[model samples]
Target: MKKCTIIGKTNVGKTLFLINFAGYLGLKFLDISLCDDKKILKKYKLSINQAIYELVNDQTHKTRCLQSIIVDVPMGKGKKKLQLIDTVGLIDGIHSNIEIRKAISHTLTIVRVSDIILHIVDAASAGRDELPSSMGEVDYQLAQFAQLKRGYAILANKMDLPDAKEGLDKIKSEFSGNLIIPISALHKKGFKEVRTFVAHNI
Candidate 1:
């Protein structure tokens, strides 16, 4: 029952990675797929409150069948369970408020409880842009966060682009010895390592 929050700023592939990573962990997740179905959300008028209500109502039934709900298959003969959470919110060195800080501060709380922090980086974005992308700030913050608990792993996503691999040397030097993997989620490359990592860590 280890809880792992896929922590990063908005649009940094946190939600997408959770689904992909769950597949690697042998879980049959039906969450976001249902959320994406326009027919369903449309049938309910696509209101956020209604969606929340439906989710809560549905989970009550699912919770009664907890084992069947959580575990998809016997991985290495029924040895493990993985819990993943994806979050959205923005933060920066520039503008912020107590509310925003409190939300971002929850990341460190998640850090404390996770067995491993899988820090995914948008490799192409950070090296090209002079300004800090979410990856840059996330890297620095999680580095500081890791000083306390949960060893972190870096996944250099979006590696399909030539520009992504172009600055590998620099990124490697910056992260030093932490396991930084070059993987393109779009291409399914580098997932074997990611799969092995999850199994090994938890």
Candidate 2:
């Protein structure tokens, strides 16, 4: 199995990309939605019907930025499965979200144990001029990930949007490797290339 982590800040489509990959892998949306430690299930006392409506009928479950780390996510690559994890969005400041903080620690475990890291960035949002951050400075999350000495690839998402090409250029020129890739998860564009790269890189 290929151990990998899908990392990006909030609203960068990390979960959305993973969900699409799961769909590509043919993962069925079961009503077995459980909260952290199954607390929400017991606290809310959610019934199966409720779960179906809340998590099932809701297609945007994947759209969530940082709720939990979905494990063993399918990517439709046959029996040779890849370990896919959706991490939380990293805030620009030191004060990270609870989910993101958990992801950072959990991601360390995943990165150490994994073979590759799929780091996605919101190219459309960040732009090519300067990296975006919660503190309105150099993207701290990008800096953090760049420090990782591991097999990783960059996906500059939202390429369909205007001004994204410039950002894509910035990433390509800045990274200078077969690492950065232009993609739009929302449009399902560049998905084939992204999948193919992960298939080979991992």
Q: Per-residue error at 42 for model 2, in Å?
A: 11
Listed in order, each prediction's TM-score against the native is 0.68, 0.66
Question: Could you tell me how far off, in angstroms, the CA of residue 80 lies in candidate 1 after the best superposition?
Answer: 1.2
For candidate 2, what's the RMSD?
6.2
Candidate 2 local distance difference test against the native = 0.55
Q: In TM-score terms, which candidate is top?
A: 1
Could you give me the TM-score of model 1 versus the true structure? 0.68
Candidates in order have lDDT scores of 0.52, 0.55
Best by lDDT: 2
Tell me which residue pairs clash in candidate 1: none
Write the residue-wise lDDT of candidate 2 on 1-202 in tens digits.
6656666655566766665655554555522222232132322333323433443221222223223322343245554556565555554555434654554555445555556677777786666333441112323445355547456778888788777877777666666654677887666777777677666655
Q: Model 1, which residues run further than 4 Å from truth? A: 32-75, 94-100, 130-134, 147-150
> What is candidate 1's lDDT per residue for 26-97, written digit by digit as tens?
544334321110122212122223323343221111111011112232357666666554433334553355
